[model samples]
Target: MDLPRAFTIRESSHRVCNPFTTEKLALLGRAISPSPGTRMLDLACGKGEMLCTWARDHGVSGTGVDISTVFLSAARARAAELGVADRIGFVHGGAAGYVADDPVGIAACVGATWIGSGMPGTVELLRRSLAPGGMMLVGEPYWRREPPDQATVEACHAERKDDFLPLPELLRRFGELGCDVVEMVLADQDSWDRYVAAQWLNIRRWLDANPDDELAAEMRAELAASPVKYATYEREYLGWGVFVLMNH
Candidate 1:
């Protein structure tokens, strides 16, 4: 029901649980520019950065649902820190089957689409809570370039080459699903580095402070291999973006 301690540890410093920088995330908010008092529901909303920041910047209000108590705590703290505590709420719960009782202006599942099994299922789940003319925000990875072999796929943390599509095909998928791709903000290599490289520092710092912790050995091994693996495979082959969609 919760994210593993290892994952929480690795992403301890992340404001958003994906490969997006604060600047880029703000860009998305500005790009969409939701009106004041817009209501939103964000599923699997790790740390609630988007809700808090958007509330502060765009005057929106929302509820965020997440499985991780740790993340929810951070999210609450962030809401307070951003002076949007009254504008946003965070709930600790399963996101897969959760839907807002009332339709919302925005429905989102960013970087945790597995909560709804995959893209199609996640879109359906989000749709349940969307108001007419409302938008959906989906964060996903696509292939920047086709991985040449199974080893490359595994290195990119995918089990199969087909796990992600190229950008054009992904846009086509949105069309097939009866949504229009209105706007998108993509993650570049630098943003990916910031997101992934921060994990190494967090791991090393945690290991330094808690040498005997049970997960230390595994994290240590990951830290050793992740840098090169990321540079070679994921950085070269994987692309991540948050797409804004409206029903067609």
Candidate 2:
């Protein structure tokens, strides 16, 4: 019912929990420009950054759901800190198959499409909770450059080359699913660095604090190898972005 401790530990300091930086996220909010008081439903809404900030900056209200109790607690605290606690709610639950009781103006599943199996199914699931003419925001990764071989794909943490499509193909996918790509905010290398490199620091800090913890050794090994792997493979080959869509 909760995210693994290792994942929580690694991303302990993350706000968005994806490759998006605060600036990039703000850019996304501005790009989409959801109107004041718009209703949003965010699935796998890690730490509720989008909901909290959008509540504060855009006057939108929403509910967020995540499997991580730790993240949900952080999300609640963040909501309170931003003085938007009254505007947003965070629930502890699985996101998959969890449709909202009421349709919303915006339905989002960012960087966790596996909840619905993949992109197509995830879009379908989001649509179930979307009001007519409402928008959907999906954060996903696509290939920045084609991986040269199997080792490269594995290094990017993809099991197979087809696990992600190229960016153009991904947009085409939205068309195939009966949606129009209205807007998008993409992550650059710096955004990737801020997200992934920040995890290394969080992991290192945790390892130093708990040298004898059961996961310390694993964290240490990951810290030692992650930088090079990221620079060589992921930074060059993987791209991530949040796309806004509406059914045509």
Candidate 3:
């Protein structure tokens, strides 16, 4: 009834599960403009930051579902801190097969398409919880520019060969899912920095406090190598965004 242990590690490390900064996430949250009183569902809602913020600003009620108990607990505390404890609920369960209890005006699976096998399957998962005319939001990654070479793609954490499509092609894949892209908020370098670099500081502090923990070795190695690898590869080439969609 919890997300895998890897998720807990990532959260403890202050790392984003995906390359979305709080600002970029807020931008996507604002872009959709959920109707007043409309209900929303956030699948794979890591720490529930996006849902809590949206509930505070947009006058909507919702539930956030995640497999990570650690994140669910943090999300619950966050909702309380924001004085929206009753407005948003956090559930600790796998998002892969979960649907909203009620038809929602917006159903989102931000940066967790793998929950449904891939982007298209994730849209189908979201669609089940969406009311007619409701928006479905999917966050995904794409190349900022055509790869200069195979090495560049690999540097971005993608396979050296063709693993991801270009930006337009990625959107086209969504169209093939019977959805129309309604709105989108893309992440820039600044946002990416917040998402990635901030984690380095958090990881460093965690390492200091838990110097001899069994996981320290792995964390330390990742912390030591990630900045160099991310800056050299992902920072320059990979871009991420959340797209709002409606059934075509």
Model 3 earns a TM-score of 0.91
**Candidate 3 or 2, higher lDDT:** 2
lDDT of 3 at 167: 82
CA lDDT of each prediction against the hidden true structure? 0.94, 0.94, 0.82
Residue 96 lDDT, candidate 1, scale 0-100: 93
Candidate 2, residues 1-248: lDDT per residue as tens digits? 88889999989999989999998889999988889999999999999999999999999998999999999999999999999999899889999998999999999999999999998999999999999999999999999999999999999878999999999999999999999999999999999999999999999899889999998888899999999999999999999999999999
- Point out where model 2 deviates above 4 Å: none
Q: Write the per-residue lDDT of candidate 3 for residues 3-118, one digit (tens) a residue.
A: 65534654564424677776666777677777778798999998888888888888788998888878878888888988988889987778997988789999999888889987
> What is the Cα-based lDDT of residue 116 in candidate 2?
93
Could you tally the backbone clashes for each prediction?
Answer: 0, 0, 2
lDDT of 1 by residue, 50-146 (tens): 9999999999999999999999999999999989999899989999999998999999999988988889899999999999999999999999998
TM-score of each: 0.98, 0.99, 0.91
Model 3 Cα displacement at 32 (Å)? Answer: 2.0
